[model samples]
Target chain A: MIPALGLLLGVIIGLALQPTVPLWLQPYLPIAVIAALDAVFGGVRAVLDGIFNDKVFVVSFLSNVLVAALIVFLGDKLGVGSQLSTGVVVVLGVRIFSNVASIRRHLFNA
Target chain B: MTQIPQTPEDGRDLDVQPSTRTAWRRLLRAASPRPTKGTLLAGVLAVALGFAIAVQVRQTSNAGLEGLREGDLVRLLDTVNQDNSRLSDEIVRLEVQRDELATSTDLEQARAAAQQRLDALGILAGTTPASGPGIVMTIRDPQAKYTAAMLLDALQELRDAGAEAVQINDGRVGASTWFADGASGAVTMDGRTLSRPFVITAIGDNNTLAAAMEIPGGVSETARRMGGDTTVLIRDTVDITALRPLSTPRYALPENQASPSK
Candidate 1:
């Protein structure tokens, strides 16, 4: 409950601030966001499955974002940034969809 | 024959089983570590994700000017330079006219001759608006194989057809216009990257232009053979709204005028 309240507070504060991201980091932000989305859905699925470990969740979330951005960065260096970004998005999007499907089943039991 | 039970499942052993879902669930269980209590990690991630999404959305919405790449910036600067040169030339011409009026004993004849020359030069130099019956052609590349060379060929074909003025998409073509290969199988004309389904509008004699382009063994037929489509329409009047900048000659003077060094 406390964590959820903290999350809500953070969201409100972030929205209110409306901070602009730095130009250098703009390219990576998109992949990072998609990775973060995948993690969010996974976290929700874990919570429903009674396996929502704090360490695991934090580690997975950080790893997802980091690995995704890293792949895109390396792709840019190799002159294939868009192709790699698409790959990352495809995998993450599939995972997110599956996790969300499971979450829906858990919620409505349908 | 084996007697099937009333229930969906039969007593006899079957190859297919309904336990695949359970297996998948077990796999999920093995992957996710079970915790005694809910962690703060999920909340933190949720907050970050929300913030990032909001920021990304806003950024994309405001990305019009900022999204231009280095090449686009260079092209923009080039266009600005051209405009600057054109305006300065006009200023110099006006100043020259002022000097002539002040110095000349007969202003009326000189003014009339200067105005006539300016009018004629304006048309030849593409500095004035030209409107007449012309043709509009749509060229579409279904397979991204159309290159800058192909575009040049088409432009030449139109020129050969006596096209006075031509505009492709929004960029106007002048005598010195050239096409360059753009990134990702695209073509760039006059510093602008043209998208698929290039619409070329040319101002000239409608029937002659159409006949020249539609001649057997022509650019249109070649485009069709290359897995592309071409549609040509001869309109009564098409506006040629593009202006070409005129650069003043510095080192080169008229043949009659002697150089300072000489």
Candidate 2:
């Protein structure tokens, strides 16, 4: 339930920021949203396991933000923003498909 | 016999408690997750907004294109008009300068220099004074399909052959005069309407200028090609001083230089 909530919040952030964001950063906004959702899920899992570390959460959050920004920046500087967006979308799409498939397999395995 | 489990002190089990309606609620909430719902809505709205902006941008760009075309046409016309005005002004200035120089003390010196140049070129300036002994050619072609531009070309050729003074049937050729079709289908010269069978009178050394015109592929030949009538009359001395000088140029040089050459 919490993970679903986090996904909802991230999507809302993406839509709100789309217009204000520059064209170069557009591709990464969706990626950032999804990454944030995953981070929330990871944090929740860590808490349940009684192994939650503040340093790890902060580091992961900061790295995700920086990496997204860097990819967009480099794409813009190389004059390949559109191509980079295509690559990012393909990778994220595949990841989502695999994750969903894994969940489906686990649920039906028994 | 059964044993009851005790609650943990840290409240972990309470946090994970599953109520009777928990599964149904989670499924309902998952089906309409916030991120998915928000993103879908935003994507649809963004597409609509982009469509509207694209339409507006296209319309604005089209308007700008039309405005630029009109501006270019206006600029072209203005440039042509300006050039016409400048040429007229320059002609007037030259005429005034010529008149003033004629009366100056330097006139005699310049005349001597000109005479020397003419002598070197095997030509005499004042020997004949370009008077008498020439054929007057009057060309008239009212029904002919020739244009005024063609007639102007002939006139130019006549002048180049050393015509001292040339006049059309009703208008004297001048610096500012343009030969073009008038509104009524007849040719217009110097803003005056003229009919067919235009008579052109030239006064110069009859033998020399006339012989010059008689050369092959000359004015007579060109007129023949245009199906116009050409008449050349040789006379000992044809007095033709009734022609009026062209109007005072619109822009004359200052009065300081109006003296005739010595």
Candidate 3:
């Protein structure tokens, strides 16, 4: 439930921030911010549920950012940045779908 | 607790079986819900956001395409006009050289040099010198709205037709030249602004080059589709001259001048 709420809030924030951001930073900001916030919310929830490790959370967050940046940088160098980003979005989309499905099961199972 | 039978015929064991079963079922249902509403809502929101982003991206791409097209059209016209002025200047210079050669004491050498220059110019213009075969191709926009790509295609066709040299609106054709738009969508080429009705000239075996250009799906066809006029004529002699030496190239050659020696 908390993850869902966080995702919704992140979407709203992204939509609002896109137009106000600088052109150079605009491409990276909305999606990055949303993903980071979503991860943070999930981490907090896990900690509350007594399943979180600070080390694991920190490592996952750092690796996620590093991988995303590396992919973007390599794509740009290869002249296929847009295509690579699209692929990343597609994978993120599948993950989001599965996450949402699990959240739904948690909220409405009776 | 022992089960107390309320009715013998009904077999009701409310004190034990029924209560235990109800509690267990309730606990099981509480542990697992069939549909999680939170997940459904999040999924829908994400999809909607993705759709919105896709629309915005498409709109931006369309705008860029239009910008590029406008830029190309403006550049093409400008290139033609700039070339015309350059050709006029070259013609003037050649005339002056001819006059000087005619009056000089070293008349024979000067005349020879002048003739050679004239011959070079003639070849560059797609004109025959004295008595040879050359083709003349005149290109103009019929509706006065031709694009840079169309002009480029025509130039490519001329080259493929075995043209030794080509000129447009009197400007010598070179690799560095390209059409681009300037302020307010005006066409500019090589810093010179130009208008429409671009004239192109080519020097070659007039008949052969003309035949090549006339091939099906060739430049002539493309020009026709673009509503541009193309006239190919075989001239007995045509005068063409090289334009003034090109300014410094945009990119410099590598500095390793002695690499081959090693």
Candidate 4:
């Protein structure tokens, strides 16, 4: 409930401000969003399993965003930014899919 | 209870079970986190992540270029660049045309001034008609002393006296006119014969021109000494009605061009 409330507040503020991301950070934002998506799915699954930890959820969210961005940045320096981004997306995609599938089953009791 | 083996060491479970269960429950309570008012940090991080995602989505769609391929973006950039350069070139061309129009108005005024000066010169050279206050000198050369040299000298005197236009015996005297004496005191001016009693018309200041020829030992005196009659009259207006024919230069070119040495 707190996460949902927080998400709503952030969306409202962002819409009102319309702040531009800095140029150096622009390349990482898409990857970070995907990483955040993975973390949200994991958090939802944990909540369903009755083992949700606020500390763990917050730490995981931060590390997911940071590591995803860092990987892309390093790959860019190494001239393989697109390939690394693809790899990261593929892995996060599978995790999010599995988590969603579990959430679906848990909610539907199927 | 039935699955447990009844051994001598396992008999302690019965005695220690309640206390150990309470300790384990205390540890679980301490380790697991529930969302309380103190979970502000987690909420804030979640908020920040949500904000970033929303902003990224907005940025991607704001330009109306969502879902465009990379090649399409490059092509759009090229078309925009071409438009910019074409506009720049058009501005430069218009500026140059504006400058030319501005200077041409000034050039037109200068050309009018030059044309006026040229007309004045044509009058003075006797290639055009002129009317002004001047003196008319009538000469009766019964003694036939108004030779070609004397006629030429008279023209020079009138020129020195500021005569702007001149005619002698119905012939317009120009810069290149010549006099040739014929038989029995007859005169040929510009290949046209003139009978005796020549009338010379000159246009200038009436007082100065009359005084010029009337001066002692002037052209009038020279004429009198040659046994010829000379009469000077100041008039309100004199018309040197004859006009010289303007010739187009055939051999002479503009000075800027190289010419063969004579």
State which candidate has the highest lDDT.
Answer: 4
Docking class of 2: incorrect
Give the per-prediction TM-score of chain B: 0.53, 0.43, 0.44, 0.55
- Model 3, first chain, TM-score of 0.60
Error of 1 at B91 (Å): 6.3
Best candidate (score: DockQ):
1
lDDT (C-alpha) at residue B69 in model 3: 30
Off by over 4 Å in 1: A1-4, B1-38, B67-109, B112-262
Cα deviation at A72, candidate 1, in Å, is 2.1
Model 4: CAPRI class: incorrect
lDDT of each: 0.75, 0.54, 0.55, 0.76
Residues A12-97, candidate 2: write the lDDT tens digits: 55455443433343445555544543443444434434454545755665465467556756775786755675676566566555
Instruction: Work out the TM-score per prediction.
Output: 0.45, 0.32, 0.32, 0.40
Comparing 1 with 4 on lDDT, the higher-scoring candidate is 4
The global Cα lDDT (0 to 1) of model 4 is: 0.76
Candidate 3 lDDT, tens digit per residue, A1-110? 33334446545654565443334443443344334434444444333333445455555544554566567667756867667767766666665554444332223321
True contacts kept of each: 0.32, 0.01, 0.00, 0.42
Better TM-score candidate (1, 4):
1
The regions of model 2 sitting more than 4 angstroms off are A1-110, B1-131, B183-185, B255-262
Highest TM-score against the true fold, candidate:
1
Global lDDT of model 1:
0.75
